[model samples]
Target: MKFYKISKDSGKKIFHFNSNFIMSRVIQTDKTTNIGCMHLEEGGVIGYHQAVVPQLLLVIAGEGYVRNDKDEYFKVQSGDAVFWEKDEWHETKSDKGLTAIVIESVELNPSLFMPLKK
Candidate 1:
């Protein structure tokens, strides 16, 4: 699993047409893609399993822990994104509640866009 930062601090400031805002690029895929939100209540867990395709989990709210094939858990919070390659084993767990947006696709390549977590 690879960790990336999608927080506003890593975003680009946009001042186009007298508009002020920050844009954090997520992903661009040409192949078929699936996007969904995942809500985990306290002590919730997404059991370890093989990723059917390249998967990117973007934590939008709350905090959690994620593990890859090595079974080492990494803490993740809002604005954090985790990527797993196809067939990679992974899992997610939360002690408190957490909400995330999950993106899955054959063409998912987050490294090309988001900066690695420092």
Candidate 2:
């Protein structure tokens, strides 16, 4: 068991193009099932992208929309949780600055989300 301080996380760009605001990534990886958080400035976008592993997104602060191939989209606000299956191309557009926590854990075995490092 372990604790994580989201406030201390450093942000990086995962992808950006014609995106006015900033889309900062707090964590990104494949070594561990669980991964990062995304902090988007108002009007930010996590441009179209795909992941090899499924991801769970928990909106911590702000609102946005996630659109996919089916032309399907939905509203995402603080406390909202959404699941993105592996290989499903999607784009997250934030009308309001957004801060979201992400959990990229093995779908069948979520226990791995527990921190093993100090």
Clash statistics: count for each candidate: 0, 1
Candidate 1's TM-score: 0.73
Give one digit per residue, the lDDT tens place, for model 1 in 1-108.
999765556655544333233445556556678766666668767777789999999999999999998968999999999999999988888899777778989988
Worst 10 residues of 2 by lDDT: 109-118
Give a tens-digit lDDT track for model 2, residues 12-62. 555454444333445555666655677877778877777557877778899
| Leading candidate by TM-score | 1
Report the lDDT of model 1 for residue 28. 52
Best by lDDT: 1
What are the Cα lDDT values of the candidates? 0.79, 0.68
TM-score of each: 0.73, 0.69
- All models, RMSD in angstroms: 12.6, 6.9
